[model samples]
Structures are given as structure tokens and as C-alpha cells.
Target: MKNSIAIRREDLNKKGEKRVAVIPELAKTIIEAGHNLRVQSQKHPETNENKRAFSDSAYADLGATITEDIAGARVVIGLKEVKTEYIAPNTTYLCFSHTHKAQIKNREMLRTFKDRKTTLIDYELMVNADKARVITAFTYFAGYAGMIDTLWTAGQRYALAGQLHPFAAIPQSIETEDLNIIKKLIQDIGTHISENGTPDDLPPFINVILGQGKTSTGAQEIYDILPVENITLAQIPEIYANGDRKKVYKCVLGITEMFRLKAAASLPAHTYAALTIPQKESHYFQHPSDFESNLQAILPYASILMNCILWAPQFPRLLSRTFTKAQWEQHQTLIAIGDITCDPEGSIEFSQETWIDDPVFIYNPATNTSTLSMEGQGIAVMAVTNLPCEFSADASTEFSANLSPYLPGIIAANYEASLENSQLPEAIQKAVILWNGEFTPRYAYMQDYL
Candidate 1:
């Protein structure tokens, strides 16, 4: 079992990524099961600071080696993307490669696998028999961090507006120790809002969520900590003008509610309009080009917008530049947004991935520009790419729990054999993007991206 499995250190260049693929407690089990483990030393040779949430000594104490060279191990696992040069020949690597759609950024990395004879198993594609995600802790935790950071952005934005508020006291996500502490702080804020209402100059705090998926739900879970009143989209303007200022109002909008048919290119004008809501939804799903951004009706009255949709270029833009400016003129209350999805210039036209070091930006839609300062008439966007890293220990604990059950078996599996005849589980086998330097049948389409 010598060098059976190794957990690589996260890339040092990636700031604020302290989470590890495996924790020390889990490493102890793998060792007790008679599999050798090597955890990359978090002790950077140049710096005294341990970069990882878990210390190297924690793994070493549990019969795991704290080694600098984990690439030589038969199985190397990580949380994020690994460099192409780090992949040892004939070795198997498990991580989120993010090249399933043949992304332009990772084309070279995918090409490197073909010559190195290394197996690339993407965690994102690891789905159970029922097609449910096997690794979901990260997505779920991301929502928690995104909304928390969004609140931080609101505090900062409000302070810039010369409005002194209690929320302005809340720190950034990474500044806090864990989710429990953050939740307690938010609960305190909720109590404060109950005792003293939000600023009268501003409208009611209407939080409009864009999707209903796991990420969206995670955001909702965090938002629920506040004294909130769930309301429908139809009750917005009236609610904003007359609703209790102390209570935060929430409205969740699905894709169909945010986007609509453009010009009826798919069917007759009247027939398309006459279609039932579900039928229209199906049609819009099949042909996204027929849809146009319809968020103007929802965006104007919102104090904060949490975008959690999994979107691409083919989909209609939800918060376009023109729409952002128009909405600002109407209400000026949509000041802060938590783009939890973090798609760069994707659905939310102005949002780009911001790092934890600089997690938010003021997007001036009027000038099509952004500034790091949260000042000016523009809206504030908190779009941290690796949000879960804010609560690294908690995130790592959940990730380790989900991935630990599969580790002992995967470490003991026979990778020398063909992938079809390998000892890997069916779900894991299906997730293999590359096997021994060749594109697996399921991932052969990736060649187009390279």
C-alpha cells in the first residue's frame, strides 16, 4: 500500500483556497484500512503560514506522510484543478477539472493528459445511478458564503451612501471563523432590525432570487436567518411602498418568470402567446434564442438580487447593461447583488469572478465599467469565484465526508486494467474523462474543444 493515495496541496497561486480534498480524520481511516496516504505539506518553504485549513502535522500524526511529492503516488486527489505538469504518468487524479464542456481555458490541460497516460476523473461529473450529484457540499456551502458576502457588500455600499447602519458592522465572509459564528452575527443583525427599522430613505429590503436549484436554495437558507416575509412578485411595488421596513421581503423567480419569448420565431405569434405556461416553458427550454430578458419587471424594486442560475451564453441575459441602468432610474434600490453563480459576463451581463482578496465591485452599467470602490451611482456586485473557501474548515469537513466513502475502494482499485474492466464503481467509471492517456468514449467529444 506504499504511496497508494496522496492528497495534493492546493495551488499556491489560488488565493483564499484553504480547503483540502481530505481531512486528517478521514486520512486515519484510509490508513487503518491498510492504504498508504500522503498529504501534501501545507508548510510553504518560503512562508511560515500553513496555507491549508488542516495542518500537515494533523495528517502525519494519523500515519499519513506529509510529503512534498504526491505526484508519484498511484492515486492523487485534490479539490481544484491541478497543473498539467503535476500529473504523473499512469497515475489517476480526481478533482474538479471543469472541462466537461470543453472550456477554452483548460484545452491545453486536457491535451496534456493524452500524452502523459494519466486518468482524469472529474468530481463534478460523479453522479449516482439516479443522476444526482455525488459531490454537492461545495455548491451548497458556496450559497452560504455568497449571501453572507452579499450582506457584507450591502453594508459597505450603505456606508458609502453616508447611511450609518448596523449591517455595516458585519465583516466580510473570509474575515469570520465559520458559518456558525456568521449565522449568530446575522441573527443579532435580525434582532437589531426588529428593534430599529432599516433606513427610511431606502425602500423595503426586497431580495429577489433568480433560480430554485441547490445553490439558490442555499442562498435562501442563509437569507431566512433574517426577519423575512415571503412575498410574490406581483406584490412588490405596493409592498415596497407600504410594507414593514423592519422585515426583509423575499421573492424567488424561476427562469420562465425572468425571461420571455422575443418575437415568436418558433411558432405563430398568437399560438406562442396562447401556449400554456408549462408549454411556453418547454418551448423556451428547447429554444432559448426565442427568449429575451424580462427581469425589468422584477429588478426595479429589489434591494438585493441573488443570482444562482447555472447559465451560459446561449441563455438570455437576465441583468443586461441597458436593463441595469433602466432599473436604477426607476427605483435605485437594487444596489447590491450576490451573483452566486459567478459566471463571467454570463447571465448577469456585468458580473465577473472576483477573488476573496477583492470580493466585490461597483458595476457602472451606464458607462459599462466597474470600480473596486463600492462608491458611485453604480450597483455593487459580490461575485467571489471560490466562495466556499470563506468557511474553509466547514467546507472541507462536508467535502471530506462526501468523498471519504469512495476513497478506500478507489485507492484499492486496479487501474492497471482497462477502464471497462477496472475495479472502480460504475458512477466513478462514468465520470472518467480520460483513461491512460486516451479519451474515454464518453469524453471523446472533448477533442473538439482542444
Candidate 2:
């Protein structure tokens, strides 16, 4: 379970609110520190009935305020920002969100903090190192188990494609520490399920936390605000059992529907921009918020598949060599690749000739960019683990499905030729494929030509 310092939300006037649930232990620590916790509340001009209900209150006595305006109260104690209207200029801002690019982009606010002498600290930096170790153990276990429940079942038993558990990516693009923290949380979940009978015994936030390891609990918890349809057991791993046509179709349909939604929502804004085929002069149709919202929706489904292999029974034994900290670090370095422009009309070439080997790419202390180049490579390897079925990370079949769409023509083509058809010449084929596969074609090419 995450600590209260990681949860607790409060409004000044609302005293009886249930509050955003957090790790109880973390909450106690803040109380013991005697820091006055505060949150922002929007005064609804339309309704005076609840106006000023929680206008002012200390962090310690939050019960009444919480109950009155549950939605109005902001969870400030753990957040990076408590709106300027709510807190004193001197109030400190402590939260993981502070590290995210969106928040950091607010240079004006940061300037205000500096001018006001308000201490803006990332508490995660202080507590996460130790917390991550414990968290990792649990998340690794939960992720490992959840993958099994979601992806594989042979009768009552489950099987794994490869002998090893796959590596799970920490999606927090900025906070490497939080990413580490999330990885730990996943390990913890895996441990709990392996030891316990039900994943229910654990806090729901724990699962949300694992799924949204990179996001703030406040933002991540908002998904619970959305309606989630109950997924029937028959729609899950049952296809591996009875193999009923109706059941299988329903299952596949349900999955395909979900994937469509996920893809739409998860597709990057840049991807959308690429799809838009903008004219020389253009007006943007979507807001950044829209992109952010949709991205959040798609990520959970992706995670469902990404974590599949982690839970397989055979995964722990077969892929042990790859999931280690050293390997994870190596893998982590590879996940971050460069961004490329795509042609909306599919006429332009977006291809890479080669992946230049650069050791300095991992951690260029001199330049201060540690994870940028590594991202692409990491994404390439992560493609295998990101799938929803039994597949080896080392297998070309899995790699092609998970990553090719995201890859440029050169890199993706290189991956296909090198891994899928080993009989093909590596040096000549890789080079030739990049040259020919430069631009995305207007029409999809059939792999089999009769």
C-alpha cells in the first residue's frame, strides 16, 4: 500500500470529507510534522448552498471539510501545486507532479515560487529511494500474477510462452526515480498475488498505481471517476479453455473494441497531428488537454498487455537473465528513442538507416541528457513484453507486432528483416530495405502475393 503522504487531499472549509484515500501511514507522518495542509476549491457561482463550506481549515481537522465538498477539495499536501488562490505565498509545494513536463512548463508559476521564497520540493526524491525497494518487490509480484490472470489459462492452469518474466517499462518519462518507484510497486503487487488468494485484499490504488506508475495519484485516481464496464470471466482467458465460438467471438470483439478505443485515446498528439495532414496555414482543432485526456485512457489497456508476460508462471524461470536490475537498467536505456515526423497521407519517407551505437547515449553527464536516445532502443525491446499474449521478447514475431507501427520505415524494416527472416542478408538487406521502405505507402502492401 502507498503511504498517506502519497494520498491525502483536503480543502480548508470542508471538514467531513472522506478525502482521497491514501496510505494511512503516510498521512500520519504529515500530521506529526504539524505542517498546515491546504487545498484549492473553486467557488461555484451557480450554487451558494455549498459556497464557502470549506473556506478555511487546518490539514489535521479535515473530516468535516472533506465531507462537505468532496469534489471541491484539492489534495494539496502531496501535490506539486496548491493553486495560488488557496495557499499563502510562502506555502511549500510538495508532489511528484512537479517533475512532470506539463507542470514544469509553467515557468511563470515556478518564477512565482522563486520570488515568494516558497520551497518547491519533490518529496519523492527524499522518500522514494527506500520506498522503491519495497515497492518494486510488490509490483514485480503483482504484475507477474496479473499478467497470468489476464492473458493465459489452460483449463484451470496457466502456461507461459517463454521461461522468463518480461520487463515492465516505467512510463514516467521524466522522473526516473518515480519510474523506479513504480517498478517496485509492480513487484509488490506480483508478490502479494503470488502469496495471497485474491488481488482484492490489496488497495485498488495499488493496481492503479502500478498501471499509472508515472502519474500523480490525484490524476490517476480520476480514471475511477469514469465508468468501467465489468469484464466477464468468460471474456477473459476462457478462450484458451472451452474455445466456444460465441464466447470467443464475444471475447475478441470486446477486446477489439477496447483496443480501438485505446488506440484512439493513446495515439500521440504528434501522431494525430501527422494524421491531420495540416495545410501550410492551419488552425488546431484539438487542445493539449484533449490529447492528455485521451492518452491517459489508452495507457491502461496498453499496460494490460504490457504486463502479460510478467505474471506467467514460467516467465520467472525462462527470462530471468533479462529482468535483473542491470538488465532493467540496460533495457531502460533502450526504451527512449528519438521522435520522428510521420506523413499523414503516407507518401513521405520516415525511415532510419542504422542505429548508431553511442555509449554516451545512456548518461551524458557532460551534456545532462541520460535517457533520450535510450528511449527508442528501450521501446524496441519493450515491444515484446508489451504484447498481451505468450511471446518471447527475443522473438521477431512479437517484436514486429508491438513496435513496427511506431517505428520509422528504416528501423522497423530493419527489425523485420533481421529478426523475422534470418535467412535474409543482414548488411545488404537492412540497407536495401531502408532505401526502398523510405516513405509509408498510400496502400498497405500484402505480405503474401499470389
Candidate 3:
């Protein structure tokens, strides 16, 4: 029998997630391949605009059946995880199921997939022969949006404190998707800063960025639009001591610079380099307890903290509550934390997953409470979970292009076949987190988490 596939609308509750797994252009490809293609009708959450990335009319025009009967299809595709109650039994569902690390929050959802005998394929795990990610993500936009949002939040906080500067003129990321518009705005801000210089009221400010990955690159792209000075991690202390009220300074730190072994004082420099040189791989730190946070030295000088590194429960936090409180009380220079990774209570312990509409919150380390406004005595946190959604059109187009190649194989695969005999491509096979409601061999480690 021919296979049937359905593309469901993202959960309405997930605001600003305008990305569609199968765009209308890809719908045509699936239909031409002789598979039954269906798309659920959906309206853009921003109803005032009345625009959707893939309108129902567009899918229908491409010869795809437009209907709400998603459960009728054998295979379901979506951009985000579907609610446990909405997942139908015995269906192949593909999405970014963030359960790879045994996330406590997603344990119930993973259990539901097992109980329903649903096949769960996680997009994040889709890898090529090199074990590198095959699925393109919105990481670039995450960094871009995060930096823009963080700068804007910092401006707001500064304005409330009666200090007006170039950042005050900056607009929100959601206001426009045109990179040129943002560039122009930042250019103007840069010009203003160069000519007028920062106000004497505020001290010399430095933006410390952690991680050198795509996310960090994206943040740097936005920051580079201004008249900024790049400083090395080793020079941070000297720059802070001398102070540069004329131009904004940025420092990017790698893993070796950001962390140290617990016994770094006694260990030889060569031994430390050997242990931390291969930083990207988990093998570097055999245990989380082996490392101590080295971020404190920079905290006293940082005006903005851009955390772009990936963090898991097994890893030590880059910024702890005690450290944050001490910095806020003593220096008062760290105005905002742009947590691009947005791992709730993961890396930046004080940061919580915030929404796009209300992107920032003031985390009061003293009370361990968060306030939506920046008026309180706390550090502003920009932790938008869906940062890339700000540029949904661009993100969806790139993601669809990357995901198209695997569609033909996925649509033709026989899910009933045993794991070893499955017709799915190796990339897809490796990505299957759950097969027939049980953890695949590659993902069996997740059983303990579930």
C-alpha cells in the first residue's frame, strides 16, 4: 500500500513558531512522488497580519489535501512537539523532540509516545556520516535575535535609570525581519556612540560572549554593526581597569578560557591543555565535577553577558546564583544576560524560558523571583525560547531546503519492518529515538531518563 503523510499546524499555544515542517513547495514534491499529502488548515497567530508561512490555499494549489483529519494519516510531520494528548497511537511522528538528555520536563511526553506505540524521530539527532547534524536549525537567527533583544533590554534598563544613549534608539527584533533595517539602525547607533560617546553616568561597558559556535557568530554579527572594539580574554582585566568610555568592547571566550580543572593550581599547564584542548567532545571532562567555573574573573567587568554555549545537567553552570548575586551587589555593571541557548535552569541558573512577546525578565537573585519589568533591583535576562521565530520566513525556508532531501526515503519507509531491516536511510535510522513505542538501540540510554 502507498504511504500517507500529514503536515499538522504547529500547536496554537506555541506563539510565534510560524515555521512549517513541509512548506507548500515541498508538498508538491511529496504529492508528485505518489504519496498522499495532507496539510491542516491554520491561521497565523499574529491575526492582525493575517499571513502564514504556508497558507492552506498555497498547499491546496500544490495538489495537497487541506484538512484537519491529521490522525487519519500514517505519518505526521511537525516543527515542534505535539501535546501528549493529541498524539495518535501507532503513528510515525517526526519533530524536534528534545528528550535526548533525559530532560525531566519531557519525560511524560516520551512516556506518552511509548504508551501509544508511536514512532518518534527527533530532528536534532539527524546526522550525516560524520555524525554532524544533517537537519539545519534556526541557530543563526537564535543568536541574531538574542543579541538584538539583549541590547534592546539593556537600553530599556539603562533608560529607566535615567541614562540615555545610542541603544535607546534601537527597536525590537519583532518590529522588522529585514536585516538591512536592523543594520541601518545599529549603524546609526554606532555613529551616535562614536561622535557623542557613552554618557559619563554609566561606567565603561564590556559585552562578554561565551562560546565560538554559530550562535556566538550570529550574536557577533549584530554587535559588529556598531563601532565596537574587540578585546582578547586575557586583556579583559586590563581593559576593565583602564576603562574605555569611548567605544563598546567585546570579548569572545572559548571553553579552555571559560573553565578550569578543579585542581588547576596544582596541575601543570600542559596537563590542563591536554585535558581541555578537545573541548567540543564530552570526553574532555570525564565528569562534571572535574571542572570549576572560571567565569567569575570576567563577571566583575562585563556589562552584558551573551551565553551562547550548549549546557546539560551533567555540565557545570557557567553562572551560578551566588556568583550573580555577588556581581550584582558589588559591581552592578552586568546589566543583562542574553542567554541565546535558553536552556531553562541549565547554564544560567537564574534564567527561565521567556516568551517572544515578553522577552525579558528581571531575575532577583536575592528573592529567587522574577519580575517582568526592569524596574526592580535585579539582572535583566533575555531568554526567549524561540528566538529564531523573529525571522520565521527566513528560518522556515532554510529549514525546508535542508529537510527536503530525506523526505522521499521517509515517505517510502515501512515502519512495521524490524529495525535492522527497515528501508529508511541510515541518516533517518540513526535519528529514530523511538521505534514501535520503544527506545531504539542508539537511544536506549534514554530509558533511564524516562
Candidate 4:
């Protein structure tokens, strides 16, 4: 059969997930190859002020069929997970199915795919020959939006406490679609800090960033816009005790520095060296139980915590209720937490995934509950799950550019052929989680989860 690919609209249930897997420019490539292309009519914000990466009309103009009939196509594509009810039997579906981690919530969705005999390909598992990720995600933007939002939330928290500072002058991430506006705001905040210095009313401000991965790099980009000093972890105490309050500080932590063996007071030099060494078989600490959280030592001095680490069920909580409550009672300087990973009850135990419209909530350690407003006693959390949507245009363009290389292989695959005989690229073949409803060999481990 001739290849026919369909691009489905993002699930409406997920707010701010406005990204499209196949932009119009890429759609033209698929159409020019003499293959059938179908795109769902995407819905956008009603106001013309909101900037969209591309219009639905743009897809139609490229000689592609634009409609809501996603089920009619042989291969379906999307940015996020599709609803199980929309999964057509015997059809190949490609998207980010988060079930790789055996998430309980997605167990039923995986079972439904098996029952419907649908072929599932997960984008997250697409890796190169070296097992490194081929599709670089919008993680940088997640950090960018997260850091910007964290500073804005901290400003609001200070206002509620009747403390005025330079952060108050900053704007929300969504206030303007143009990234330059946000960059200028960050620059302005830096200028103000450099000139007037931090207010005496506020405690010494230190931003602790966890993980030095792509997410942290993105967060640092926004943070560097401010006139701040980068200090080593060993220097934190000295600066906190005698450093200038007028200036801000930043510290980045790696895996070894963030956690130590549960039984040992500190990680030994050999173990630390083994983990720190690069290109050495990628060996590190085996299990989460082997380590204990080492974040408590720095909690007293932090004004903002940007968590960029990837956490799973096996990992220990970065900050527990007891620790947070004690710090809150002491009236610690920590005011805002940017849980950029947005894992619900994951790394940051008090964290819950928040929407773009309602991005922040105050987590009351005393009550162990959350309130929408940043007022009252508690630390404010900026946990927007879909941070990239704030810069959807640029994110989509980057995402599509990375995905373009695999398009021909994806569209030309013969779904009828046996899994091993299929003409898909090795990367795509490796990403197949389900073949005709049964778990693929690479993903058979998910069978227990099902």
C-alpha cells in the first residue's frame, strides 16, 4: 500500500501543549515525496495577539489534506500521547508514550493498545547507535521558561510578604510572545541588582540549581542575564556569612555532589571519582537506595531552587516534608522552587504538576497542602508541566528540524511486513514499544506493567 501519514492535534485535555509534530514546512516535504499527508485542523487561542508557529491553512496550502479524520491514515503522529479511544486497530501510531517508566496512570493505556492490536512507537526511546538521544527535545526551553517563571513567582512571594526588590520589576513568561522581551526583562533585573543592590529586608539571595544537564544549561542562560556571581559549593558558607547581599549567587550540583551513600556520611573519593569520570562505560551509583539526599546542607541559604534532574520512583526525594517544614519554621531564605521536571510527587515531594494558566502554587509544609496563591506561609513552586509552550514557535521549529531526518524512513515503512522485515531505520525499529498490540522485545519489560 502507498504510504499515508497523519498528523494529529495535541490532546485538548493537556493545556498549553500546542506544539505540532509536523510543521507546514516539513509537511511539504512529505507531500512532495508523492506520499499522502493528512493533518488535523489545529485549534489556537482566539486572540490574534498569541503567536503560532504555523497556521492550519499553511498545511492545506501545501497540497496536504487537512481534516480531523486522524483514524483514516496508516501512520499517525503527534507531539504528546494520544487518547486510547482514538487508537485505530492495526494502525501504526508514533508519539511520546510515557509508559517506558511503567507509570501506573498509563498502564491502562498500554493495555488498551494491546487489546486494539495497535502498533506503538515511542519518540522518547529514539536513540542513535551509541544509545544517545537523537531527537534533542525542548528541555532547554523548559529550563528557560522555568527560570523566568521562578524569578517572577519569587517576586510575587516577596510582595505578599511586604518586601520589595528588583524581581518585582520582572514580567511573567507569557506576558509577551517575543523572547527578546523576556530577555530584556532579565537584563533589566540584572542591571537593577548591579546598581541598587539587594534590599536589606530580604535575606541573602542564592539560587541553587540541581543537575548540570541540558535543562540546567537552559536555566543558567536566563540566570546569567542577571549580574550575578557563580560560586563553588565550598564557597557558599563563606559568602552567606560575609558576602554582599546586594549581589546574587548561583551554584550548580552534579550527581555525586547531590547525594551520598545512605550508610556513609559522605561518598568516598574513589566512588566519587568513578562517577565523575567521563566516557568510562557510563557506570555510576547503581540504585537510589544506595544514596541519601545531600541537599539539606544548602537549604538554609537558598532563595530559589531550580530542579533540573530527572527523577524516578527508585530515587529518594530531594526534599522531604519534615525538612521543608523545619526550614519554613526557621523562616529560612528559601522562597521559591522551580520544579522544571514537573514530576508529580516525584523528586520534590511537595510538587504537583501545574498548568501554564495556573503555573504556581504555594506548598504549605505545615499542612502538607497546596494553595493556588503565593500568599500565606509556605514556599512558592513554579511547576509548569509544558514550559516550552511559552516559546512554541521556536520550539516547534527546532523539534521539527530534528525529526525531519527520520521522516522518510517513518513514512516508507511497510506496516504489513513482519517486525524484523519492516523497512524502518534501526533507531525507529528500536523505538517500537508495541508490535500488533504485543510488547516488542526491546519493550517487553513493560508487559509486567501492563
TM-score of each: 0.95, 0.25, 0.92, 0.92
What is model 4's C-alpha RMSD? 2.9
Worst 10 residues of 3 by lDDT: 43-52
* Cα lDDT, model 3, residue 110: 93
Cα lDDT, all candidates: 0.84, 0.25, 0.82, 0.81
**Per-residue lDDT of model 1, residues 218-306, tens digit only:** 88898899999999888988998898978788999887788877774667668887888889889878888888888878776888899
Q: Cα RMSDs of all predictions?
A: 1.9, 25.6, 2.6, 2.9
Residue 38, candidate 2: Cα error in Å is 6.9
lDDT for residue 181 in candidate 2, whole number 0-100: 45
Candidate 3 residue lDDT tens string, 23-95: 7887788899899988877663445332346578888988888776777688999877788888999999999
Compared with the true structure, what per-residue lDDT tens digits does model 4 show for residues 291-316? 66778778878889999999888777
